[model samples]
Target: MSTSGKKATATALAQKYAPQIANKTVLITGVSPKSLGATFVTAIAVSSPALLILAGRNAAKVEETTKAIRAAAPHVPVRFLNLDLADRESVRKAAETVLSWEDVPSIDVLVNNACIIGSEYKLIDGCEAHFVVNYLHPFLFTNLLLPKVLAVKGRVVNVASDCHRWHHIRFSDLNFDVSVSWKISQKSAAHLHPKQNGKIYNMWQAYGQSKTANMLFSLALARRLGGRGIVTNSVHPGIIQTNAASHLDPAEIPRLIEQVELQCGLANQEITSYKTVDEGTATHVYAAFEPGLKDHNGAYLLDSHVADPLEDPVAAWGTSEADAEKLWRLSEKLLGENFEW
Candidate 1:
């Protein structure tokens, strides 16, 4: 499909799902202005959800998003909560606060939209920063709030990326401590390669692996929660111009863009295929409320529909029952909390 066609389809899906948001209690993470999360919150607010919780690490940023949503949606109830995904304690406290809410009956939707891209290497609980911020944190938070979500048979929309095509889970050395050097000859193929100077950590590889984790988590969660009436799905929101790339060095942007274009096999090298924030966020909105998706649990969505794993190799790996189960077990070990459900 052409870019314009994709955009139109996304807009139509958003409108189609708008009515489902009314009176639903929705909680979304990562709502900074112009970010995908903010776009989801704004689009959903039009339908006047009963309560909208905007979560992020920065209180001021969350407040700014809240103000914008309120300005556009004066009647919608919007609340902001400080949620630092890198810290396990903060995630726990935030989940506790939501669980303690006296008036809110149930959470209808939980959008794990918060994620980071290129950044210097760091560790949280002995895990890579991208892996923790993008995958583990969401895993912990979602499991923590499972009871509330189950109460309403809610949906969990994980904002994953098609960038998962670049890498798969590095189970042996997830932190890049031992298995650092790697190469992606083509966008679809990536593997470890010995470096002359020893291990060399690459931020892009870390980011790609983290995204793969998102898909794996969604598949595993959906399988586990399937019979419980709760739905879980991951979405590749397409490439979009967002602050997600703010951490990238300015000189690297052009090269990265060119590489992405080449990998996507776009004929016009001069024209990038990035989507506007609205079009990029539409799949997330669609995945969160599409009634037909109830039977499509554990599915990965692209362009607002269930994507074929055969079309994307990384997605195929993510959907592997064995890999998903391994990831789930590893996550439980890392978090020190075994989820019963």
Candidate 2:
């Protein structure tokens, strides 16, 4: 169980665990400037890991992050891995490239952190864009790279969120097509509505559904890796200023902010009081190095501690064993491959 209170900062944790980070190879996706992933890598860079592999879709953005890392720690060895989470083939190629890299050691910390946030309805390869990019692709990439992670008995960190409480998986209506989504109800079967009400798709719910999958996927992977000395956990990096929500209309920003505050019980505080990018990166950095988490595999971390279901409603629903297995099967079905491991 986790206690509720102030959280540790990423820089402090990195300094405290410098030796542990020094010998490990870390891979993180979505390392764009001002984003959580970039901040996370920056924090890790100071400690001089064996190798820092930054991955993303844009070469320029990844280069930008690489420059920042160089400035922070010039001697740190950093490499770029071209990864486009929206494209399944790109993910496969990225994983294959990693597995084939003879110069790099086994991945000691695999952080599936890149994600997109928006209200618009779009599809990738006939699946919902949010579902595909946020959950499906990372799911594929992680499983494909399991060999590297397992070789070092490394841990996995899935950047999930508290927003998951806003909606269920919508198993029957994954795309949230207005025509099909309207059919779901609170009275629907467990697979259709896991504690969520019957409602049409909205920007919040769409993002929520994908985030829920992140947590469930963490649980499923942990179960499968039983007794393997590998810890897999999900984290809710606190709300912070980032470009993730750029897809939403500028005018809708305030409304979206207000909604997030209210839903996450921060409505009483001002927007400026939201966590800074470095602060938001704390729990992620903490999760990556915290040795105590080995006994708490499949846990959801928040504010730099394992989240308590009593303190956060999302914890219980996000960790449902049944939901985890269900989402795992569906993910395999969507990818047209069964991961026997």
Candidate 3:
């Protein structure tokens, strides 16, 4: 409920505390050998946590990152866990794996730093891929491990984006089943129209919705978990080039970039809005272990400093006391009784 005398955005805080990235026992999801996720992983590699769990879907990239981390600090133990966020079971299994690791019971920090753009409204485990991978999966992943995090009273840093402001999440339509009579997936996703009249929406529309959900989740988590000594905040890691674009329609990527450039007044191919992967990773680092946030809790941070989330995401997502309560219950409902966490 208090600022803890801190004055920095997620980006600024990361820059200020660049030295703390090493040996911090951080778990960065979606990390790769050559991505912003990896860059953040490398930066924090210096902090040298007793253990660093480098996770991603690719075993090869995870191994490459694990090797790089070990080379950077021979004594620091680095482990790898392959997780497919799109699959709920994979996320749950990943939680079990991380919890079972030695020296991991008391986690120091959690960086929900995975995201994507230009991907279609495809379904993963029957939900939109962008929504599931970017928000729902991570939300479940975090709540599942929340006990471990709270046990150590650690920091939670969620990576969010400004694209959240682009569209409002249709919580009612998230399933995309009602519109298609319950048939939704790669095949149906391709045919699922997201626009009426003349416009370009659909695929990225769901993406925008998910990002907003992430921000709202961060806001809600900050409020709900702050009292537990767990400082939870979200960040916009900046628009940097990464493989997240791989799933995006290649031809449309350039067009979207061009539009964003004009709106932001940046030069064509300027890369101004985008930073190096290392730079992008800084915000997450700031959130997880920045000295400034040592006394912080329950605040949404952007770039590294505490910034208001895109408009009122909590309100947009579900601000009603009843709605928030309902969301928790709904989450539990979807997760099933097997997941006692």
> Evaluated with lDDT, which candidate comes out highest?
2
Residue 83 of model 3: what lDDT?
A: 85
Evaluate model 2: give its TM-score.
0.88
Q: What is the C-alpha RMSD of each candidate to the true structure, in Å?
A: 4.7, 4.5, 7.0
Summed over model 1, clashes come to: 0
Model 2 lDDT, residue 261, Cα: 52
How many angstroms is residue 51 displaced in model 3 relative to the true structure, after the best TM-score fit?
Answer: 1.4
* Clashing residue pairs for model 2: none
Q: Where is model 1 poorest over a 10-residue stretch in terms of lDDT?
A: 186-195
Better of 1 and 2 by lDDT: 2
Q: What are the per-residue Cα lDDT tens digits for candidate 2 across 58-170? A: 99988988899999999989999999999889999999999999877489999999998864777788777888888899999999999889888898999998778766787
| Candidate 3 ranges beyond 4 A from true positions | 1-23, 175-201, 247-254, 257-273, 294-296, 308-329, 337-341
Model 3 per-residue lDDT tens digits across residues 161-191: 7566554454445654433333564345435
Query: On a 0 to 1 TM-score scale, where does candidate 3 land against the true structure?
Result: 0.76
Best-first order by TM-score: 2, 1, 3
Candidate models: Cα lDDT each: 0.80, 0.82, 0.64
Off by over 4 Å in 1: 1-5, 9-12, 180-198, 249-254, 257-271, 311-314
Query: How well is each residue in 1-341 modelled by candidate 1, as lDDT tens digits?
Result: 22223473344555676788788999999888889888888877777789999999888888888887888788999888779998999999999999999887689999999998887888788888999999999999999998899999999988888777666787766766554334533212223443222145677778888888998898899889889988989988876768777666656666785685464443323434567788888788788888889988978888777887655433466677888899999899988889988
